[model samples]
Each structure stands twice: as structure tokens, then as C-alpha cells.
Target chain A: MNLKIALLGGDGVGPEVLAQAVKCLQSVEVTFNHHFTFSPALVGATAIDQTGNPLPDETLEICKNSNAVLFGAIGDPKYDNDPIAKVRPEQGLLKLRKELGLFSNIRPVRVYPSLIDRSPLKKEIISGVDFTIYRELTGGIYFGEKKLNEKGTVASDLCEYSEKEISRMAHLAFKAAKNRRKKVTLIDKANVLETSRLWRKVVTRIGESYPEIELDFLFVDNAAMQMILNPAQFDVILTNNMFGDIISDEASVITGSIGLLASASVGTDFAMFEPIHGSYPQATGLDIANPIAAILSAAMLIEHHGLNEEAQAIYMAVENAIINNVVTSDLNPDSRFGTDYVGNYIANSIVDTD
Target chain B: MNLKIALLGGDGVGPEVLAQAVKCLQSVEVTFNHHFTFSPALVGATAIDQTGNPLPDETLEICKNSNAVLFGAIGDPKYDNDPIAKVRPEQGLLKLRKELGLFSNIRPVRVYPSLIDRSPLKKEIISGVDFTIYRELTGGIYFGEKKLNEKGTVASDLCEYSEKEISRMAHLAFKAAKNRRKKVTLIDKANVLETSRLWRKVVTRIGESYPEIELDFLFVDNAAMQMILNPAQFDVILTNNMFGDIISDEASVITGSIGLLASASVGTDFAMFEPIHGSYPQATGLDIANPIAAILSAAMLIEHHGLNEEAQAIYMAVENAIINNVVTSDLNPDSRFGTDYVGNYIANSIVDTD
Candidate 1:
């Protein structure tokens, strides 16, 4: 099988860590006897410097014409300090998501046995914790119309949602639940927000079609606390965009393994995978940044395409790397492997696998 | 000194737990030699049952005439199951807040030394965690104009904030920081939402006035993660209504002692204190309900009235109760103490103290 993969290594350590993902993918290509054509495109700060546009039209064109997109990270400090700047690196990614019609974000948070002790939570609480968050990406407060009065004293943002928008994601969650834990927990502030009422109405109607899957509701505040108290109880979490942004990030920290988390922003015809960690600009050239998250992201991309065995090989390689202690300083300060060494080790692990 | 207190022990365990608070407050009055008059009023589910109104004019009048209000929890499962109910038990609290002009909500999350092990987080992470969240109560998306489109398919809620709203809360937070850790962290999603940008601008400007206190900013997502990773790092957290509701609750659970959290909602001329826990309708008539939160709320009400020594006495008595293992079932299952027993023990401890 031949696949077209677009690589958008944004800024800072994005290019460095993304290189490791590319190497691992190449190894998978060799072991699986599959053809993967790689296309490099500019985005974020790098694109802004070269073409004066954080997400160039050409880059979007390449992504549109690809089977899947492998994204690095985006953002730079210069853009961060300038709060009023009209153009920013994050806008590039947001626009690309809109342009690509990617409306749902899938983040899988699983506690690895080896890293359980690293988590802030007790081992007993997070031991068997494995859950995926399905967050609506396109149609919440983030994309709503924003306005500031002429005097600049008052500012407002609209949070709007439609049944069609919610049912699209609700169907996905219920479908996923049927394959996994068969439980869906919808998080919202339904007690207060009108939009949340609409969510409850729509999601409940959609949930009826999937009777085999159990459905429940939790207010966002209680859900935030539940994520810490009993994270194991959750199977699949569905929430609006803003709530998703906050809760997913909260879920990421409890696992105590930011370097191993991967996420995918998917649409009807397109899907993009990337590490959940941001680009470590300080370690851009230091060769100490962890590449495991990037590697696992590649695994997600493989799994997204239904390459089950190929994805399993990548997962096994990652597990082996942890067991063998071939990781960056973030995971193990005493480790001798650099970023390149760990990447190569994982790639070789893939090649050496039967 | 003489004072008038209104007790609105609305539905469920609200009345049961509030009785414990009243006992402790009476002890404070006796020990401090202060004249106190107590008034009872109807609100919430009980109010709806008696007066057919959640927040009756008579109850509002009583609260208005009182110097301080001691509120127990509200809400009932019956109202919870009815989504389209025109009147809710919570609407009473919202109306009271608006009627009394209460806008700033203060919730302090502190980890007691004896209860450190009860938390899900490691002792090292939460041992010294102490922070107060100053949440804007009367504004933001909760109170914003909500609308459903003509077809009823589209729903929207507006989140608006004025500089005046941000500055009022900022001043209070900064002032409190000066008396505590001298640091304030403003949490918002400025990069995505335009209102957040306004928050940054207004807060940064106000922060400039306080040359001593250090002001920093964090995206709401990062703030959520930090609450679990390192809650001790926060001194005073100031945020808008929505973000505050989520993060404050997140912070509360990190202490691993939900039965011990207390909160206060303050305005220019009025204030109300209550336990952060809701009215557990199932635990209504049971003696198993914990009263520490309600008792601590009484302590907060005293503190709000400038009775520092009296408030400290209540705190010390509660601390002693925890030390001597006189807590309810929520804190220790094996301990033989009912809600009234724990409340009586704390009151006696206060009376016995020098």
C-alpha cells in the first residue's frame, strides 16, 4: 500500500523531535513492505519567517492532497509576548484545522505501568486508567464571533452550537464506546448554560440509537474533580471545545507522562496526528528533548489508517524502549541516549522485530 | 458586640449539617462574650414547597436586614431530574447573589497536615498547598444573554466582561496577596479568546499599580494541569466566573478533603458564607453527614465580620477535632461520631480553650 504523508514541522524543537518520528515511520515502511511518500511543508514561525504566512496556501494544498498529516509543534516566544499581534503561530494551526474541515480532536490518555510512579496520583488510583477524550474542535467559543467595544472597556465572545454539530461528535463517541468500554460520559455546564441544554438534548437523542452503550452526564466542575478522584471510572469523555481544551490538558498531567501522550484531529476525509507536548524551544538544538511522544503520534497515524499490525509494531517498540531504558533525560535523567540515539533505537527495534 | 445572623438551611442535608454550624457559632458567641441573634428563613426546595417560590421576598427581606448570612447547601434530586423546570433550587442562590449584589466568590484550598494522606496526590505535592481563588461571581457567561434561534436548533450564550469587572476582582486579589504570599496568577485563555486578551490588558495594568506583588499569567488549560502537578505554587488565583468555577473545584479535590472546604460570596454591602459541598438529598435525614465544611464556613463568616480572634478560635477547635479523630464518617469510617457529635465536640473544644 502507498500512503502520502505531509510533514509540518513547525517551530523550535518541532523539527528536531519530528525528525525522530519520520525515522520511525521509515522503519515501519521497511518492515511492513509499504510505500509512504513524505511531503515537507512550512508552518508556524518557520513559515512566517520564510513566506510571511504562518500557514501558507501551498502547505494547505499539500495537506489536502495527502492521506494523512503528521504535525510537529507550533509557536515561538516572540509571538507569545506580543499579545496584540495580528498574526501568530497558533492561528496557523487553527486556520489549517478550519481549512481542512477537521472538527473533532481525539486524545488518548493511558497510564503506562512503568511510568505510574511518576504520576502525582497514587498508583492504586491511576493504575488501570486508560481513556480517550473526544473533543468538538470547530464549533464552540473558540470559533465564535468576538468583539470589543469602541472604548475597549467591554469584550465579549459568543458560545454557540447546533444539533448537527453536536450529533456528529456524539455519534463518533457512541460508536467508539461500542468498541471499547461501552460507556460515554458527556461533560457540560448544563445546569447554567443554554448551549449545554442543547448538547444534552442532542447527545441523548443520538445516544438512544446506541442502546448497548451506557450514557451519563456530569457538570464540568464535577467532571474536573472526578478526573482526579476516580479517573478509572471514565471510558470515553465527550465535551465542547473549551471544556475539552481544559479537561483534556488536566487529564494529560494526571498520567504523569507528558512525553508519551499523542493526539489526533480528525475530519471526514482528513486526519492529523501529533504529540501532545509543545515544542521545547530551549532544547531545540540540545538533543535532550523526548521524542517518544512524536514516535507514538506516528503510531496513531498508522492506527488511524487501519494498519493494525504496523501500529502494534510501533507500540511494541515504544514499550521495549521504556523497558530497556533508552529514553531522553525527561523520562530518565541518568540515561545516556540523546534524542537521535533514542529515535534510532526505536527505529531499529521496529526493523529487528519479526 | 451584637450581631444578627440569618440561617437559610435549605433542602436535604443542608439543615442537618447547618445545625452543626449553628452549635459552633453559638459557642463562639459564648466564648467571645458577643450578643448574637439567629433568624431562620425558607429557601431552595423547602422554600418551593412552602411558598411556591425558590427565593421568596420574605427570605430576601430577612437576609437584607441581617449583618451576615450563614447558608447551608441547596438543590434536590427532584429538581435535578427536571431539565425544563421553570424554577430551580439554585435559582434562589443566583437571585440572592444578584439581589444582594454579591459578585466576588472566595474559595480557599488548604491542605491540613493531618489530612495530607487523604489526598490523591503525593504528600510532597500537596503538603504545603494553600491558595485562595477569587472568582468573579455575578458576570461572565453564566449571566450573559442566552438565546435559542427561531427554529430552536441553534443555541448561543454570550460571555462578556468589562474592565470594571476585571479590575474590581483584581484589586481584591492583589490586596489579599499583599497580606499573604505577595503573588497573583491570572488564569485565562488569552491566545484563543478575545475577552481573555482584554482580561490580560486590564489585569496587567492593574498589576502595575502593585509594585510589590508578582503578577503572572497562565492559560486556563495549563492552569488546570498545574493545579494537580503543583498546587502549592499558587498563592492567589484570580479568574473570570466560568474558569473560576472549574479550576476552583479542581483545586478543592486536590486537597483530598472535600468534606472540609468552605466558601464565601461577597459584594459591596453584603456577604454569604456556605460549604462548597452541595445538599446531599440522599443523606438528608442521616446522621452520617460531615459538618466540618459547614462549621468552617461559620468560621469564615466570623472572619468576614472582622472577628479575627473569634475566627481563629473556631479554626483551632476544628483543627483539634481533626487531630483527636472526632470527625464524621467521610473523614474516618471507623470513628464513632455522628454529625451532631462532631459539631458538639468542636463547640466544646472552643469552650474549653483559653
Candidate 2:
């Protein structure tokens, strides 16, 4: 098998943690006898510093020409702190998503048995929790036409959705559900917003194609509450961009392992995987940032390309590391392990596996 | 003191639970020696069934004429289950808020010491979880202009905010914070939305006037995660209507007492108090619905009218009832006490107080 993977180590601890994922991928290549090429591209604040453009033209080209892209993280405090800054690091990732046509952001949240006690929720409530969120990207209010009156006293943002957009993500959610629990909960405010009504109508039609999968609906507010009260009940949660941003983030913390969550964003012909955690600007060069999320993202990248066995090998290695408490300070505060040690440990585990 | 109260027992268990609140209020009148007039009106599905209107003109007239309005729950499963129904039980509430200019919706989430064990979150995360959410009502996405394209394939909803809308709620939140921990966290998506940036600009200026109050900002997504990860860190959360609806609901469950949560919607000239819980259509005639929320709303109504001592008395009596285990089945599953019993016990506790 031959694969070309684009690496976008955006900013802060991104490059540091992403290097660990590369080591694991190299180990996979050695053990599985696969030919893999890695293409490194600059993005976010790093790109801005060198090229003055968050998403340089060459970076997008490399990503477009790859089998899949494995992203580390984006954002920088220097840009975040200045409210008046014209160009931002996040705009780079947003542009990359748009340019690559990556429209569905899928995040899976599962409670690891070894870390169940670390969660804010009771062990009984979150013990068996396993769910994925299929979020519609590239549409909705985030990309909507924004307006401010001449006097600057009134401001507005439009939240728009097309049947095409709704059905695409709905199909993805249904497809994912077919392989898992066979249930999909569409989170929207159908009773209030016209867009939500359209979501319900379109998703309902999509559900018919996958007759074996069960379809249900929950208002966003109730979904937020239910996520805490009984997170185990959910299988696949499909929602629009804004609601998805809130719900997925809320779901991330429930597992007590934000550092271990990974996400995949895909379109018709392109896919990108990344850790859900932001670039920890404070942990830059400190060698203390967790690398499991990035390593798992590398696993998702392989899984996206139908390399299931290879992906599972990486997953098993990561799980072994977690169970043995070989982690950075974030997971085990008393541990003296650094980012390199954890990454090298997981990579060696993957290679050493029969 | 003399007062006139409008009671709108809306739908399902609304009337039943409201009857309990009225009993407690009657006890307050007897003990505090206040003259009060009670006027009952119809709203929600009951109003739709009886008068063919959710918010009848006569009901609005009664509410406007009264000094304050104490509302019961709203909505019915019949109306909710029918997606095409033009008139909904919730339309009454939205219309009433608009007509009365109720621009601020305030919900206080407090963890009751007696109900700590019921919380889904570990005790350490929820203990001392006392915060108030000041949600800007009568504006934003829910009330925004909505459009479904001619082809019925596209839909959009506008989220608009004016300086006035943001400032009024900012003042309420800041004022509340002055009486609280003197910190206000504004939740908005300022990083992406033009409206949120406007919110930040306006709220930041408002914060200057509140020199003693500390101000901070959090994106809605981060705010949702923080609400669960560390709920006690918040003193007052000020946000737009949509975020408030979701965050307040999320905050409600953390206390493990959604049935005991109360809310107040107020304007310069009019005020309305109601339980945050919806009318449980399934529990309509079962005599199992919790009345504590409605009773607490009655307490807030008195507080709104400058009856602090009287309100505190009601709070103390309700707390005593909860402490003594005189609660409905919702709070104590083993107890055989029904809604009527809990209501009578709290009412008697109020009257017997020294």
C-alpha cells in the first residue's frame, strides 16, 4: 500500500506533539510493510510568520494532492489577544477546510475505563459512554453573511442551510450509525428556527435510505442537558455547525480525556484528522503536552484510508500506554514523563506488537 | 401592602403545580399581613383548546393590569407531537415577553445541600455551585426573521442584536454580580460572529461603569464545557437568548434539581416569574409533578415586588421541607408523598414559622 500524508503542524505545541504522531506512523510503515510519504506544510501562526498568509498556496496544494491530511492544532495568543488584528490563525484552518471541501467534522467521545474516575461525572454515569458527533461544517452562521449598521449599534449574522448541506451530513451520520449502534439523534431547534425545520425534513428523508438505523430528534437545549445526565444513551449526534461546536466540546470534557479526543473532517474526495484540543500556547517548548490525541489522529488518518488493521494496532498501543499510566503530566500529574517519552513509547509499542 | 397578581396556569400539570404555589402565597399573605388579589387566566394548549388562541387578548389585559404575573408551565405533547400545528403553546410565552418588553430572563442555579447526592456530577464539581444566568430575551435568533426559499430547499434565520439589547442585560448581570461574587462572564462567539463582537464592545463599556465588578469573556463552546467542568467558578453569566437557553438548561441539571429551578423575566414596567421546568404532559393528572419550582417562582415574584423578608420566609420554609424529606416522588422515590402533600407541608411550614 502507498499513502501520501500531509502534515500541518500549525502553532505552539502543535509541531512538538505532531512529531510524536509521525514516529508512530513510521512504526506502522515498518511493521505493516507499507510505503508512506510525509509532506510537511506550514499553517496558522507559523505560516503567518514566514509567508504572511495563514494558508499558503503551496500548503493547500500539498493537502489537495495527498491521500489524507493529519493536522496538529492552530491558534496563537498573540493573535487571539489583539482584538483588532486583521488576519487570524483560525482563518487559516477555516480556509483550508473550505478550500479542501472538508464539510463534515466527526468527533468521537468515549470514556476510557482507566480514566473513568478522572471525569467530573460519576463513574456509573459515564462508564460505558461512547458516542460520535457529525457536525456540518462550511455552512451555517460561521460562514454566513454578517452585517453591522453604519452607526455600528446593530449587528447581525445569518444562519443558512440548504437541503443539500443537511442531507450530506445526515448521510454521513447514518452511515456511521449503521456500523455502530444504529441510532442517530438530530440536534436542532425545529420548533423555533426555519433552518431547523429544514434540517428535520431533509434528515428524515435521508433516514429512509438507511431503514435499519433509528432516527430521533432533540432540541439543542435538551440535548445539552441530556449529554450530562445520560451521555451513554447517544449513538451518533448530527447537528449544524454552531450547535455542533457547542455540543461536541461539551461531550469532549465528559470523558475526562480532552487530551485523548481526536476528530476527522471529510468531504467527497478529501479527509483530514486532528486532535480536538487546541494548541497549548502555554505548553510550547515545555515538552509536557500530551501526544496521544495526535497519535490517535494519525490512527484516524489511516482508518480513513481503509487501513483498519494498521489503525487498530496504533489504538492498541495507545490503550496499553494509558492502562500502564505511561502518560504526560496532564493525565497523571505525578508522572515525570515528557511528550517525547510517551510518543516514543507508543511508537515502540506499535512496532514491537506481533 | 397591596398587590394584584395574574396567574396563568398554562397546560398539562401547569394548573396543578400552580395551585401549590398559590397555597404557599396564601400562607405568606396570612403570615406577612399583606393584601393580595389573585386573577387566573388561560394560556398555552388549554387557551388554544378553549379560546383558539395561545395568548388571548384578555389574558394579556389581565397581565398588564396586574403589578406582577406568576406563570405556570406551558406546552403539551399533543401540540409538540404535531409538527405542522401553526399555533404552539410556546408562542404565548414569546408573545407575552414581546408585548411586555421582558428583555431579561434570569435563572439562578444553586446546589441544595440536601440534594447533593442526586447530582450527576461528582460532589466536588457541583458543591458551592451557585451562579445566575442573565439571558437577553425578546431578541436574537429565536425572534429573528426567518425565511424558507421559494424552492423549500433552503432556509435561514437571522441573529441580530442592538446596543440597547446588550446593554440592558449587561446592567442586570453586573448589578447581580455586585450582590454576588463581583464577577461577570460574558459568553459569546465573538471570534466569528459580528454580533458577538458588538456584544463584547457594548458589554465591555458597560463593565467600566461597574468598576467593582470583574468582567471576562468566553466563547459559547468553551462556556458550555466550563459549565460542567467547573460550575462553581462562575458568579454571573451574561449571554444572548440562544446560548442562555442552552447554558441555563445545562446548569439546571448540574444541581440535580431541575424541578426546583425558578426563572424571572422582567422589563422596566412589567415582570413575570415561572418555573424553569416544562409542563410534564405525561404527569398531568398523576399527582406526581414536583411543585417546588412553581413555589420558588412565587417567592421570586414576591422578591420582585420588594418583599425581601417575605421571600426569605418562603425560601426558608421550602428549604426546611426539603431538609426534612417532605418532597414529592421526584426528589424522594421511596417517599409516598404526592405533589399535594409536599405543597401542603411547605405551606404549613411557612405559616408555623416564628
Query: Model 1 - which docking category?
Result: high
Model 1: how far residue B230 lies from native, Å: 0.9
Instruction: Specify the highest-DockQ model's number.
Output: 2
> Model 1 off-target regions past 4 Å?
A78-88, A351-354, B78-88, B351-354
The weakest ten consecutive residues by lDDT in model 2 chain B span B345-354
Q: lDDT of each model, Cα atoms only?
A: 0.92, 0.94
Instruction: Please estimate how well model 1 matches the true structure, expressed as its whole-model Cα lDDT.
Output: 0.92
Q: Which ten residues in a row have the lowest lDDT in candidate 2 chain A?
A: A345-354
B-chain TM-score of model 1: 0.95
Encode model 1's per-residue lDDT on A205-225: one tens digit a residue: 999999999999999999999
TM-score of chain A of each: 0.94, 0.96
RMSD of each: 2.4, 2.3
Q: Write the per-residue lDDT of candidate 2 for residues A289-330, one digit (tens) a residue.
A: 999999999998998788888998999999899999999999
